[model samples]
Target: MAYQCDLGNNQTVYLDNSGSQTIVTTASGSPGQQQQSSNSFETGAWTAPPEMYRTPGGVTLKIQAQGGDRWIQIQGQSSNLSDASSIPLQEVSQVPGSSQQPMQPMQPMQPMQPMQPMQPMQPMQPMKMGNMEMNNNPMEMRMGNMEMRMGSSPQNTGSQRRFCSQCGSPVQPSDRFCGNCGHKLS
Candidate 1:
């Protein structure tokens, strides 16, 4: 039998029973790293504390496991675990007050510039058909039980239009094959 519990942020603790023995494993992923710990013990009558588990980030697990033939093992730098994992890697290099001799003096900060507002784009006027100018409206027509939708084609040089035979979707003039339905434009 195997059981697993999440300690948050991809960290997990797992318990597995193998014959007469059981193995408990804990894995935690700190800000920039990952670490795992495991313990093995025989299944026997033993006493356990009210809280028996601890994660790498000092976030305590309220588990109780007392006495048994328990063998515990911890891996990775304990100092790293005690510290906040969220600390940026760039900050790790420079200590707060630690004075290391600098090769050069720091440069002065530059002044900020005022922001300019953007101008809105002008709307496009629709093309004229015959003597009447057509408004910017969607073209809609019907043929028997089918509804026909139309739009201006930039690629089509002539008034002729093409469609996909499989799905009956419009096909571009420049394209040799159907773009929508994948059917060959014959």
Candidate 2:
């Protein structure tokens, strides 16, 4: 069984009973600058009162045993062992034959399957403009008598092409009325 006593100002005392021997440890200071000291002795050593133990840093612990209970008092403070500032040390372990159960192990996870490849996209249908049809891939437009193909070819420079202002369809230079919508051309 193990017992602990907290003496405020970042200092604590621990007592562990290991059958024939008893271990006493004193720990002080903050987390990054901590200092600890421990001493072990026969369990019969604490059978009497006023037993003094000094730490490495010059702090002293005054231990007393009374009525089958052990009490601790820090030196340089108060000499009274039963005062309110004094703390009693006793066993802190769980009682025997408790109903608490142990934890179980976790199971392994299954592996994932790879994703299937995506299908290729289908080609789009040609769009219709007044009386013309336009193929978007190569940029070819066809109307009544004029057909315009836009690309790196020099035969279709697009300078001789004329379009109706109203219907936006290709028209010849000599035509007076648009063939697609019959709109008057200037």
Candidate 3:
């Protein structure tokens, strides 16, 4: 004792009361005349299932046996009921305007360079004579505290000048060009 037969707008016709009596017939277009029939008195002008049924892209439908499930919503392209279990193998080739997605190309970028400038140098000459100033004999008055060494000392190797054997005169004390001219150049 269960009931539901709303072949109404969206359509839903499913019946199977435990055992016995079964009928299912649908018609929209000629569909090659007919595909299935079980006219048990052929009820109604037969024109429900459209309150919101649809097909063509988005589809929805259901029908189970043993008095249970039932539903159908179609908008176009009706195939009664039984697409051999809904066809979907990528809809089997149908290309009109071409569109499955895939395309890419774009690249252009290069420009950057600038830097050069360096040249200026000429100035050098200094070994000795930045106003020469140095004259402190006695090695600094004997360095570590005097010990008597009266000038005329440093001749370790230069300018002890005792000249004038005859006239080179540099004889230390007193005139005698004869020392320089004194004809004594020792």
User: Which candidate ranks first by lDDT, i.e. highest?
Assistant: 2
Descending-TM-score candidate ranking: 2, 1, 3
TM-score of each: 0.24, 0.31, 0.15
The residue ranges of model 2 lying beyond 4 angstroms of the native Cα positions read: 45-74, 77-85, 88-186
Q: Once superposed on the true structure, which residue ranges of model 3 sit more than 4 Å away at CA?
A: 1-21, 27-36, 39-53, 57-61, 67-186
> Residue by residue across 20-41, what tens digits does model 2's lDDT show?
4556777788868987777665
For candidate 3, lDDT tens digit of each residue in 1-186?
222233334333322222332233332324355332222321222222211233444344443434444444422445544332342211113122223444556667667666666664443332223433222343222222212234456454443334454433355534334433445322
Residue 38 deviation, candidate 1, in Å?
0.9
Report the alpha-carbon TM-score of model 3 versus the true structure: 0.15
Compared with the true structure, the alpha-carbon lDDT of candidate 3 equals 0.34
Task: Point out the higher-scoring one by TM-score: 1 or 3.
Answer: 1
Task: Provide the lDDT at 121 for model 2.
Answer: 55
Better of 2 and 3 by lDDT: 2
Backbone clashes in model 1, listed as residue pairs: 47-66, 47-67, 48-65, 48-66, 52-63
Candidates ranked by lDDT:
2, 1, 3
Look at candidate 3 and tell me the lDDT of residue 186: 24
lDDT of 1 by residue, 1-186 (tens): 345555567766555544454556677777899877777666543343212234363533222233434433322323333333321111123222223454587799889897788886554566544544443344544343333455753343565566676887776677777777567666
How does model 2 fare in lDDT?
0.60
lDDT (Cα atoms) of all candidates against the true structure: 0.49, 0.60, 0.34
